[model samples]
Target: MKIYTRTGDTGETGLFGGPRVRKDVLRVEAYGTADECNSAIGVARAAGPDPMLDAVLAEVQNQLFVVGADLASPNDSPYIPRVSATMTAFLEEQIDAMETELAPLQQFILPGGTTVAAYLHLARTICRRAERVVVSLAAEEAINPELLPYLNRLSDFLFVAARIANARAGVDDVPWRKP
Candidate 1:
């Protein structure tokens, strides 16, 4: 397929099941934000955080594609591989693993530090945005019920992963302070 399909030039785009929607539709917004989050993770991955971090991030990137497909494809349209409770559980397991390696949090930290750590923080915010959009979309229409929990866990995973990246880099978490 040619890279320039020009199909979306008119402010509309096609969905997985052969239907078009305006670019600003909730479904479009949800998947678009998911894509944005995935791109940030990709940059973080490219920065070479660590072998273990690299592996988790690469898996997260692949999983986000599944999330995008779930958001883009209509429900009741066929069995497309989707975000599932198992996936969410896996994130929880990873979170537990990372948390054990991190010191207990006493306060909220500002989002920054090493370059890859900053990128992980950036990805976390984008993941949160995607989750919000996905929630909004769920409220308005049918979606995989599993997606919300998956995204919720994903944001937590990103936050934990960012801390791990900073820790491995020998950088402390930048704690927030009152002005």
Candidate 2:
């Protein structure tokens, strides 16, 4: 199969169920941002985090693929698996576990520390953008209601994971300070 399909040259892309939406549409933007977040996570994983963090990131990367697939497929399609309460629950568990290992946060954190931490923070922001776009899309149409909660929890997971990465490496989180 040739890589260059040229099908989207007209700024239109196909969703899994049928209708072709404009490339710039909210649905497409939401999934595309998810893809971008996956790539950022890949970059962070490649930077060699601790074994546990690396494993968590690997799982999260797979889940992000599921997220992107869920976004790309039409809501009514039965062929695709949508995000579910189980998925979000697993993230919540991970977040809770990570929190137990770190000190309580007394202040807001800035997005910087170790390289892996920085990348995770960057991915968190991208996940937030994806979440926002998905929320906007949901407002305009029917959606797989679980998606919003999954993305919301995923961002929370990313934030804590980044902190854990920094803590494991003996790097302190850069806290925000009023100038």
Model 2, 36-147: lDDT tens digits are 9999999999988999999989998999888888889874677887788999999999999999999999999999999999999999999999999999999987778899
Candidate 1 segments exceeding 4 Å error: none
Q: In lDDT terms, how accurate is model 1? A: 0.91
| TM-scores vs. true structure, each candidate | 0.96, 0.96
Candidates in order have lDDT scores of 0.91, 0.93
TM-score of 2: 0.96
Leading candidate by lDDT: 2
lDDT of 2: 0.93
Error of 2 at 21 (Å): 1.5
